[model samples]
Target: MQVLTITTPWFSRAQEICAKKKFDQVWIEIVHNDLEETFLEWVASLSPIRIGMITESLTYSSDVHEKEPTLEERKHKVERRLKYMTHALVCDEKDVGYLKTSSRVLAMWWTPAVPKRFIKRQRKLASLPYGIFIGSVYGERSKIIQNPELKELMIHQQSPEHGTPYPFFFDKMHGALYHFLKSRLPGTKLLFLFYLHFLRAIRQRCFSLWLEALQNGCAVICLPHYVKTYTGRVVEGMAAHMPVITPDIPDRPRNRALFEDGVEILLYPENDPIYLANHIRRILSDPGFSQRIVEKACRKINNFHTCEKRVQQILNWVETGEEPVYA
Candidate 1:
């Protein structure tokens, strides 16, 4: 009955979910320095046995708040925390990676489960293009934008306005709205549309950028590398019927398409931006080719391994302590 949830001292959906299931105790694991006792106190208010698992690592003290931790400092801290947890729930690869190396309790990504009705809703919603990507970008890790060709396709123009979230979000929104309205407007100039789309990319987040790009002229989306392992942004994008351009990474055992390469997803040769761009242009130019891709994507989305069916698997994991079966 003693269960522990070890996470950065931030607000966690996993912690709330675990609490709703009534775990006997929930612990928030944090680094030793620059620790917030208030977060621990909040957890204590939620559960009787809340505890803080502080690692032996020297993180930035509040006095050194402006400084970020060195790579070595982070590794040592993570290693120490790995040794501290006996039974724990984890939400990211870093946590899973740590668990794999340590003798700590088994870890789970604690991914969100889709409701049955939501699956049906998503199926209906899938016929239209819908794209979304949440969470901050760690430096140099965006799969699509990092590619020279993909970046050329995705980011039309750069904004000198950096860092502030409000300006970025608003600028993107205005640009998208202008382009969206222009496309519908009876004599909207092509040059005007191009200008709007370029400005949009500079201001919007990843998903919004995707939307704006599609509005201007793009037709396909590459698989987002952002989501954790078990979750499939590819499936979601496919379900929405956007022809997807994905990388052929051998390590990705779960997303291997059972169908032919072009029919399922146009899997490009490893990191060949020219090949990727060529395939992208092919799909955009050929209507029949694009439809086939959309059909295949929708087919894959409808088949087994949907979010709705995964709920039972998640529940089974909570109740019976087993890894959910992948269909």
Candidate 2:
């Protein structure tokens, strides 16, 4: 069978799967410019049995008033696209309901391709006395710097340029604050690094930096976000065997089902930096507790959230016309 994936940004996971030779033929068409036209053309050229992966909302009009598409619009776009392909793969489960009654929609989780040795090394490095925060200062992430509880924490924040190429932009006020803090408190242990480019360079730089941060920190802290999806940071943190603390999203059933609070993962109430700090301290002070959580999380990742496993799930669905059965 032949598989054709039409995706935006061309995430590494999609690229890896398309490279496999097991499929009679595999082709990936990235929507760089003129997204709607390119998408329609690809669907017309590909066979009906082809599997198309939609990484982002298709209804996003470049002419919008610099505002994001509403949930309804996103769903409508997804539903419209499903009619052109035999099977569709979407990143979020929330968008599945938009598909046609006869459409086959597969809700695929974003899996990381972390190596075992790298995970082991991160665990060893996490023995150090520090914590790391990996994200930007935009949107809800601004709370991280504003929270007084995080002021004294020996945290290393790595803000890389977001992967998507878009026109929307935000102020760099947090960058100025980061620099001022560094100068004001010369003795402070806070560290900051910035990448000016997009995700094309991420695959090359992200793992090493992530491993370095995980190795140097006792835990990883993810700030709250409006979008409740399972981000790459959470998966990467689990693979590194580092206890991760992030806001709880009750609406996201996949995350709720896959992770357990105070067991395989840690969840915090939104915008509560004190709770975040407390969790970090708890993990650092109790080595036994930290080790248990790390072990459980790593086991979960190995069993369900690896790139290899996700690929098999996709293949099974395409072949059997059945939903993926999770353990």
| lDDT (Cα, tens digit) per residue for candidate 2, span 148-202 | 7776663655543334322122224334545655465432222212222332244
Judge candidate 2 at residue 289 and give its lDDT. 95
lDDT for 152 in candidate 2 is: 66
TM-score, predicted candidate 2 vs. hidden true structure? 0.67
**Model 1: per-residue lDDT, tens digit, 21-75?**
5544555555443433454444555644432333222222343333344645664
Q: Any runs in candidate 1 off by more than 4 Å, and if so which?
A: 1-98, 108-218, 223-233, 255-260, 302-308
Q: List the global CA lDDT of all models.
A: 0.47, 0.58
How far residue 138's Cα lies from its native spot in candidate 1, in Å, is 8.8
Pairs with steric clashes in candidate 1: none
Q: How high a TM-score does candidate 1 get? A: 0.48
